[model samples]
Structure formats: structure tokens, C-alpha cells
Target: MLILKIFVFVTSAIYACIAKNIILIVADDLDVVLDGMTPLSSTRKYIGEQGVTFKNAFAAVPICCPNRGSILTGRYQHNHKIFNNSLEGGCYSQTWRAGYEKNTFATILKNRMNYNTFYAGKYLNQISITISWHQY
Candidate 1:
């Protein structure tokens, strides 16, 4: 039993040490094809060069709030139910709070993967006091 416990502890510690860090940067109206990244040379040098870059990624929703919802929940606009940047469109609406907010990528990383997560910048157009750091 002591040997098993020691093995478990050692394995857990090793796994924790090897856990990769995650960084998600969402830039609005920035297009790679249009030389949008040229101004962020320092960011490109420090983060882009050292990290994996998705050169061919495209947003399925093409609009701010709906696209953000899709990014967070890893769902299509139809599945996430966010049609636009309005409360009526389900951007930070009660339905989104109740159904989709709890299961976002940030929440999953923080809860299931045991990662310390941080979020900054505008989330959604209709987002107000209902936002929490833990839920971002």
C-alpha cells in the first residue's frame, strides 16, 4: 500500500510538471491575409514564434458575439444559439448563462484540466454584471 501511494504521488507530480500551458488570443477584425499581424511584431516574436500558430483558421460565424460564443463553447452558432451581439440574440442571455456558459473551454480548462485561467478584453456586447472571472 505504501509503495502504491508513493507511485501515485510521483506520477501525479510528474504529470503536473508536464502539463502544457494554454493561451488564447482573440483579435477582432484582424485578418492574417491583410497583414494585420505585422503591427504586433513583439507579440509575434515572443508568443507566435514559440507557440503553435493556426495559419489557416477561419471563423464559422464571422460576427463578433456569435463568433466569440462559438470560440468559447466550441460549438456552431446554431448549437450555441448566439445569433448576434444583442441580449435578444442570446449573447449573454439567460439561456446562454444557464446552458452554455458553464461548459466553455475556459471553464473546462480551469475545472477539469486543473489549469489556472485568465481572460481579458470585451467578451460579448450584452455582457454586463453577470460575468465572473471563474466563468470566463
Candidate 2:
């Protein structure tokens, strides 16, 4: 099935690569002891010399789909409002998803900032996750 892609317009009226490139990798069910208690905390001890970290970083929910929705949107799951793939029975299911379920941080950042966004991991209700495509 073809996923409907929404491109957010640049809020500044001009697309310029001014901000630092933030590469956030979200691995599900990852052992906290191994990677990090938070997204970039434990890992930061090693990379701290190179960048910043957040220990108190937490999500609205522990679930992958919603938690990711929070991280991407920088808002709670209720704000983004996408609970899971089960929404509308499924993203590409027989039923259609409401406008709310589709809103996300990545979508908004890309829309408002005109960011060339790329989501390379398994996401809740995502239409695609093929490695070859993500890599490209």
C-alpha cells in the first residue's frame, strides 16, 4: 500500500540548513544497561565529550509507538494523539485514520521547518520500514 506523505512547509519562508543535525536512534526493548536509561544519557558518558545529554529524559508512555510519537513531537502522546498501529483498526486497514492520529513531531518539524526528514526504523502505524529504503 502507498502511504500518504505530507510535506510540511518551511515556517521561515526559506529552507536553510542552520541547525545542528540531530540523529536520534530509537531502539525498542533495548537493554537500558547496555545503551542508555534515556535516549542519549548513558551513551553520552562516552560521547559526552562530543555532545550534550539528558538524564531526566522520559516519555509520556513506555510503549514504542506512542513513546516515539512523544520523542518526535517533543510532546506527550495525548498531544500527538497517536496511540498505536491499532488506530482505525490499522494505518492502512479497512478504516481511515483521523487527522489527529497522523500528526507527529517529525511530520511537524518537516512541515514547519522544511526539514528533509528521514525515519529509518520501525514506527507504529508506519507504512514502510524496509532497510534498503531507509538506508537510501
Candidate 3:
């Protein structure tokens, strides 16, 4: 039993050491086929070359706010309830914060994997409203 416990602890430690790091970059109005990645050489070198690059991901919605909601929550616009860019459409609204924001990928990473998640870009259309890091 002691040997089995030691083996388990060693295996868990090794797995934690080699755990993959995840970085998600979402750019609006940039198409890869139109030389969008040309100016981001450092990003290409560090993140693209060193990590997995997804080649075939499509937005669940055509509009920006709904699409961003889908990306954050890993849900369809119907599920996330952000249909457009206005607060009435659920963009940064109290409804979104109370109901959907807690279920985002950032929350999952921070809560489940113990990842130190960071967000450094535009989120929704009306993100000028006060928002704290812990909100999402």
C-alpha cells in the first residue's frame, strides 16, 4: 500500500509539471486568408509554433456580441442569450452577469484547472461598464 501511494503521488506530480498551458486569442474582423497573421510574428513564433493551432474553427453567430458570448461560454447564442451588441441583447447586461458569465471558459480554467487566467482585450460591446476580474 505504501508503494502504491508513492507511485500515485509521483505520477500526479509529473502530470502537473507537464500540464499544457492554454492561451486563447480572439481578434475581431481579422481573416487569416487575408494576411492577418503577418504582423503578429512574435505571436506566431511563441504561441503558434510552440502550441497547437486550430485551423477550422467557425463562429456560432455572425454578430460580434453573440459570437463573443458563444466563445466565452462554449455555448450557442440561443443558449447564452446574447443576440446582439446592445444591453437589451444581453451584452454586458445584468442578465448576462447574473446568469451566464460565471459559466465562462475563464471561470472553468480558474476554478477547475487552477489556472491563472487573464483577459486583455475587448469582451462585449458595452464592456465600458464597470467589471471586475472576478466577475468572469
Q: Highest lDDT among the candidates is held by which one?
A: 1
**Comparing 1 and 3 on lDDT, the stronger one:** 1
Which tens-of-lDDT digit does each residue in 11-57 have in candidate 1? Answer: 87898999998767887876777887889998788878997677688
Instruction: Give me candidate 2's TM-score against the actual structure.
Output: 0.51
Tens digit per residue, CA lDDT, model 2, 1-136: 1232223234233336456565777766544467534675665566554665445665577777667556654666666655665655233332223443345555555665556667654655555542212232
lDDT of each: 0.81, 0.53, 0.78
lDDT of 3 by residue, 26-97 (tens): 777656888888888987898789976778877799898899889888899889889889999888888889
Query: Which residue pairs in candidate 2 collide?
Result: 8-111, 72-105, 73-105
Spell out the clash pairs found in candidate 1: none
- Clash tally for model 1: 0
The clash count for each model shown is 0, 3, 0
**TM-score of each predicted structure versus truth:** 0.75, 0.51, 0.69
lDDT over C-alpha atoms for residue 86 of model 1: 88
> Which 10-residue span in candidate 3 carries the lowest summed lDDT?
127-136
Candidate 3 regions off by >4 Å? 1-15, 32-57, 128-136
